[model samples]
Target: MSYHFGRGWSKLTPYLLLLPGLFFYFLISLGPSIATGFFSFTDATGIKGAPIRWIGLDNYREFLFMGRASLDNLDALKRTLIFSFVVTTVQFTLGLIVALIVNQKLKFTNIFRTIYFMPVILGVVIQGLMWSLFLYPLGGPVAKFLALFGMRSEFLGGQPTEAFAWVIFVQIWANL
Candidate 1:
């Protein structure tokens, strides 16, 4: 070993081997995060060759003050919060009940556990896309089922109220 490497070389070798990964992580993670933070202070339209403008706090002010000037905006925000609260409450309640049920000594507990935990195995984006396909317009299961009951309408595309309900439903269903 001593003949193959210079004196003290092995002591530094592990760190040397680690540099590439460290550099790669810095490039992909930290660099992008810092750059994004910086860009948040600037107006970056993301268009090729578009001039970037430095506008500090303007974007934040827009969102934070969006409702104060307009009653419509404030109502929209209230509605959004209500939807969020309902979905979170439903998810928590169902998850707790299912956890308790599965923890009990009963037949088919394994199957029930698997069903409850299956969504947790799926990545968030994959779960969203899977549910979207099953709920989307025209060829979607929801639309076809509705058609059978004399209800004909596009779910994800046409109906905003129904679409929002489905969003909350899927969110709770996937999370629970």
Candidate 2:
């Protein structure tokens, strides 16, 4: 067995091997979070280099204390939180269930595994578009199916409750 003791390059070999993982961890994970913090402090819009003036904590303060603030933005934020929470919880539960089933020697395991992970392979934009199509009033499958039960009432429109309900429902359904 070839062994080296107190060699210069060999001492740092482990760190060299971990370079790729550390790089990606900082780039993909920490980069966005730091960028979000910076963005939150500025008045940047979707446009790049659009005179991003620093606004400090103004955005968060306004969001918290403004009585007549834009309802659309508030509702969207709420829906985003709801969608994230419900989708994460439901997908984790479903994954555990599938894992247990497969551990018990379920048949066609590979097919089932692929089916469960299919949504993960889909891009976020595509998944959002798919859900939007599915939630459209009177045109989507959900609305059409609800019509059979006389419960069709523009599932993705009309009011905040209806819109958010479909958002959470579709997020959980497709994610699992």
Candidate 3:
């Protein structure tokens, strides 16, 4: 009887320990997801004691099939897809190449790996700040470097096309 009881308790212990984590996961992650889905079908103004009514996909229809909003949304979706593809392809290619180089038997392999991994360890906010300072329009390292070549221009705050290119470059660098 004692052996059987011990075996049963041992089998159940892991699950017992997991219960709190599972509970919190449901509370924090799943609860909000379900609530959002439910609210999507209703006209919830989010005001205190506001009347909530079921609108039955009207919101989605308006955003997807209606006037100017649909065009804007489609444009946003296209940009998002393009960004994702470019980032994913570039990151994968660069990562694989770097990994191959780092995996080889070389004297400075550790130093190279550390240099490559530095950006990964840094937080996004810190990376953004660092890049902004480095690319700042006035007296920045990049601006100074460019000025040495008799060229000066705002980097991040420049024209739309240039700014977008810089954004993509910085994103790839940081992510790599």
Candidate 4:
């Protein structure tokens, strides 16, 4: 037997081929997205079958105006914004510089171009894990070298400012 599509059926082939993708998209992506949007307006405890009361704007109020709210969430937001902006700026600047250097027709610049794109081939999780290992203060080689001075505090466990600083530095190092 052979599979064939008549001229009429050919017009529907793309949709037929896309059905599986559409099914999975609705099941995995759209379903959760709509649920999240709906849940935002309700007080739904994570417990299965629990009652979910409509509490429109109440949750948003606490996050926006509660006294202690700013200390926790707002501080985190500020730090994240700063870190992301700095890292993006560095990436853009470095990309431009590398592109300029590689465009100069230098012999070894092709090697640098290959090296620069190597990170792009790795998944974000893998790149993050590799950088984490590089900066791990306990048993990492970098930390071992610092251990000679009797220092043992991990990069991320130090003071808040310093820890955030290292986070920015490590992100830039990994991405650049």
Candidate 5:
């Protein structure tokens, strides 16, 4: 009868040990996010310290509602949405294509995989600086390359459409 089932504390011991881990999990992950969500509704900035005024829905209303004070914020929101959607779709398509290619029995499949993932292994700050250098309007490689072909346009600074397209093209090129 004693060995028919485990002792009482034996079963509960594992769960008791797991309690600290669960507490830390909530503290590290969900705690900051919830705090940030609460702060977002308040006009809390470092410079205007001390008193924090709760702005309710003023920020969201101004950005999303009509006849608001700052239409530039609305336009920026639209551009951000469009950019996010386009980047997501394009990156997903590129990933699929890369996966399909890498699934094949190519001679240099491992090498190709390493090359493709190399950028991801690199530091984000370094990558951003590198691209900022490469995409600089006046003296970047892209502008110079276009100039070589007698097709000159400010690849990064000419216009919004041109800048956006160039950014997308560079993203596709470097990522895939």
Candidate 6:
């Protein structure tokens, strides 16, 4: 009887030890996800003592089928898709080219690899700050270089198209 009891206890020990972590995971992660899904079908303003009413799929319908909001949402979706496609394609091509070059028996291969790998290891915040400093419209290195060639324009703070291009460039630079 003692041997069977010890075997059963040993079998249950790992699960017993995991109980607290499982409890917290349910409480913190799963609980909120379920609550968010539930709340999505209702009108809850997050105001204390506010009456919550079930609106069903009205909100989703408005977002997807209704007025000016739908147009804006579709435009945003289009831009997001374009951005994802451009970034993925450019990053893959550039990475492949760099990999091929690095694999060759060339002088300064280690140095070239290090230069290409530097942006990947750097934090996003550091990269953003460095780019901002380099591209700052007023008296930045890029602006100064452009001035030397008698061509001056804001790289980041310029017109919408220019700003968008600069953002894409920075994202590719940091990610690659």
Which ranges in model 3 have alpha carbons more than 4 Å from their true place? 1-6, 107-111, 137-152, 155-157
Question: What are the lDDT figures for the candidates, one per model?
Answer: 0.82, 0.77, 0.87, 0.81, 0.78, 0.86
Q: Using lDDT as the measure, name the better of candidate 1 and candidate 3.
A: 3
- Candidate 5 lDDT over 1-176, as tens digits, reads 36433687676777888999999988999899998888878887857557889998876776677575467777877778887788788988988999899899999999998978878787767777887888776878877988898876564656888777767666665665
lDDT of 5 at 103: 93
lDDT of 3 at 115: 85
TM-score of each: 0.54, 0.56, 0.76, 0.65, 0.62, 0.67
How far is each candidate from the true structure, as Cα RMSD in Å? 7.4, 5.4, 3.9, 6.0, 5.1, 5.4
Residue-wise C-alpha lDDT for candidate 6, range 104-152, written one tens digit per residue? 9999999998988889788888888888899887899988988999988
lDDT tens string, model 4, 32-71?
9999999998999899999999999888777767889757
Q: Per-residue lDDT of 102-151 in model 2, one digit per residue for the tens?
A: 66766788887776677789888888888778778867987888888988
**Candidate that scores best on TM-score:** 3
Query: Which residue pairs clash within candidate 1?
Result: none
- Order the candidate numbers by TM-score, best to worst: 3, 6, 4, 5, 2, 1
> Any residue pairs clashing in model 4, and if so which?
none
CA lDDT for candidate 4: 0.81
The TM-score of predicted model 1 comes to 0.54
Tens-place lDDT digits, model 1, residues 1-176: 35444567666777898999999999999999999999988989999999999999887677557656556666778879988899989989998888899889999999988878888898888887888788777778877888899987644544767767877887788878
**In terms of TM-score, how similar is model 2 to the real structure?**
0.56
